[model samples]
Target: MNTVTRPRILVVGAGFAGVECVRRLERKLSPDEADVTLVTPFAYQLYLPLLPQVASGVLTPQSIAVSLRRSKKYRTRIIPGGAIGVDLKSKVCVIRTITDQIVNEPYDYIVLAPGSITRTFDIPGLTDHAFGMKTLAEAAYIRDHVISQLDLADASQDPVERASRLQFVVVGGGYAGTETAACLQRLTHAAVKRYPRLDPGLIKWHLIDIAPKLMPELGEKLGSSAQEILRRRGIEISLGVSIAKAGPEEVTFTDGRVIPTRTLIWTAGVVASPLIATLGAETVKGRLAVAPEMNLPGNDGVFALGDSAAVPDLAKGDGAMCPPTAQHALRQGRHVADNVIASLRGGPMRPYVHKDLGLVVDLGGTDAVSKPLGIELRGVPAQAVARGYHWSALRTNVAKTRVMTNWLLNAVAGDDFVRTGFQARKAARLKDFEYTDAYLTPEQVRAHVEGTARQE
Candidate 1:
């Protein structure tokens, strides 16, 4: 039997939660005491709050993807893999490596922070026809898709198809949906000036939501102001409605309004990664339930945080769970780290409690809406505050510099709207993202075993 001397801590993500756990472990433990490992598909911590900017071409995609390995070399071993499942009874995790290999790793302690995937609904033709604005790839694809639509419209002779191609519809009124519509519209406005043949008046952006107000989190006054600004920009805001159906050439809304368009960006919201539900533990709103200590109930050395775990917001009464936001995720990550360190040293675990900081909505261009530290601001000052917050929130200096440089260049030279046309063929397929399942089918596994037996 192989004897292990050092304590092993396996973290199942590189996002706010996992990263925070690793950082704390490194700071608290000496090199001789423990080893920290982070398992994530990508080597970067995605700054999700600014993902809409990437989609809208306000900032390049790389600006938001801070390199995980580079930032945490002193703390943990970064494994490039997607965690598939956990054997909580054995403290083992099954991870699928980027190279398509699955391996089980044992650990003394575990932290689950797998984050989330787009929360999709059962609307007809939605998954097959709509574009998503969740990840880095999705943002890049959206930029290309938008530019390509403009290109196709500019070259097309059919007025109806051109109009259809020019029309862009975004579902959801949360930060993601609202910012996506705002930024993309700004992009189209800037780009159409370079396209002489295309009439800018023909291009339209529609923001739809089932909620009564756009950016309802911003309070009624600020939300109304934002809605008015978007409306002034020639964007349509539809409330109390959602996309009923999406097709290759058209979309039908719940309000019985049909619009012909090739673009439908779905940013309704996010749900915890399905892996959390598979843990067989109590969950709140589909997230793994965690104690105030950030530890799994009745399980020693196991913890969860971030979007994947439904940690209580004691700050809010009546058993409220923390909203899945980057700010909360970040604080939870740090708190979880502290709790883990306390557990290791036989110290008391502290309850996590953080007051709500203000939210920022970057509307692209020189317009923004923000409430920083409970102070509200709009227009260019709000835009500056929004961008400033994102800049300061980034993990590393390099990320900050890169994002600033991109902003400077964008302001000076304007948008490039250059379509890469890479993901065009793979567009319109959820299966292409490898989201449903990552493992081989039973038949395929059996066939593989048979082939191996014959070879032997």
Candidate 2:
């Protein structure tokens, strides 16, 4: 009797690209043709764009965290772990399981989509004093921390302490920083109503960025429109300036200006996943270098996408690589799956080419700005477009329903201004939340793999 061998495919990370790749693979290939395995610490794909809403109590975390196991049609075996290293020559991936067990996952083909980490600078006290807005835990902690500041300020008799507590400084004018400042500012605005003893005039929000413009991707016209909205809302906008030093109670800008504040939210930018360096391959900026089809050059059976890979933008056609965005990630996920299957079947592979759809910035409430397909829109029309795009992008029906319901509930009932006291019990800092120190070096990777092999 002759037996047929099936190919095994492994996908790392459960972000937008990873999840979409698995979904496409499950739908395209039969169970007898290949076996699919996914490596991730969490079983859910976080809708990262809505994270600011989660931070501001506009939506629950569960609503944006779409479960990977929700579909009965999903047949991929999920390894509840994070990939720490990859040996291209050995075709083996080193994964640290949630239980802290190190294991090797060998595969016929592997996809790296580990995603990005919050980018930080070397400024003094930045890592120790600032809070990040890159993950769900950080968002939740920020919400709690913000409300706690209000609670503490309300109870304080010291004028200086109260003033410091009421002042907020957000660094970064990109989409993440801008949205974060806008949403959390709205949170404080509504929250102050509950604190009758607190002076509303004392509450201040300062948004500073090293860039000359806010949301520059929105273009000059729409970007200025968004900035106007924020400025009208009393948000202090500072361009071409950044934090020179961060302290526990105050931050000094490079312009030699000092501001007193207990809260500092950092959303400056993101760097490609540290796992990219494990491959020791060519890289663009910090992302792994890959063909337009998302295949790693000179490395057979290896593919990369999402924030981890520098994929060429064939649509623009001027040697420009695709910008790291959810739009590109989602499309790249599906396209890379197709290319992988082509490789498996000895068929032709297609290159990834996509055009920019537009940009959207929701500045809390009905205030928003958007440019869809080059049509500039602001106010209520832009809000509709922004919400419409997000609603359409949600992966599951349940997530969509939950998010919509949360939006409606938040609109009708308003935020309750409650803090869960998470930051009070533990320190919430950049390093504390991101775990940047936990990643392994190349030497450590080899040692761990050899040690595990010896034990086995």
Evaluate residue 420 in candidate 2 and report its C-alpha lDDT on the 0 to 100 scale. 78
Model 2 whole-model lDDT (C-alpha atoms): 0.91
**Tens-digit lDDT string for candidate 2 (1-456):** 111468889999999999999999999987787889999989999999999999999999899999988888789999998898887877889988989987899888999999999998899999999999989999989999999999999999999999999999999999999999999999999999999999999999999999998888888998888888899889999999999999999999999999999999999999999888887889999999999889998989999999989999999998998988999999999999999999999999999999989888888899999899999999999999999999999998999999999999999999978777696576768888766665777777777677777888
Model 1: residues with Cα > 4 Å off, grouped in runs: 1-3, 71-75, 428-431, 439-456
Model 2 pairs in collision: none
Tell me which residue pairs clash in candidate 1: none
Q: Model 1, range 1-456, lDDT digits (tens) per residue?
A: 122778788889888777766777788788877788899989888898888889888788888898766743476788888887766765667778989887677788888999988888998998889888777888888898899998999999999999999999999899999999998999999999988999989999999999888887799878988998899999999999998888999999998999999999998988888677556678888899999778998999999999989888988858998888888988988888888778877899998898888899988888889998878899999999999999999988999999999999989988887887665575644434537466344344344445544776
Candidate 2 backbone clash number: 0
Each model's TM-score, in the order given?
Answer: 0.94, 0.97
Candidate 2 local Cα displacement, residue 152, angstroms: 0.3
Q: On a 0 to 1 TM-score scale, where does candidate 1 land against the true structure?
A: 0.94
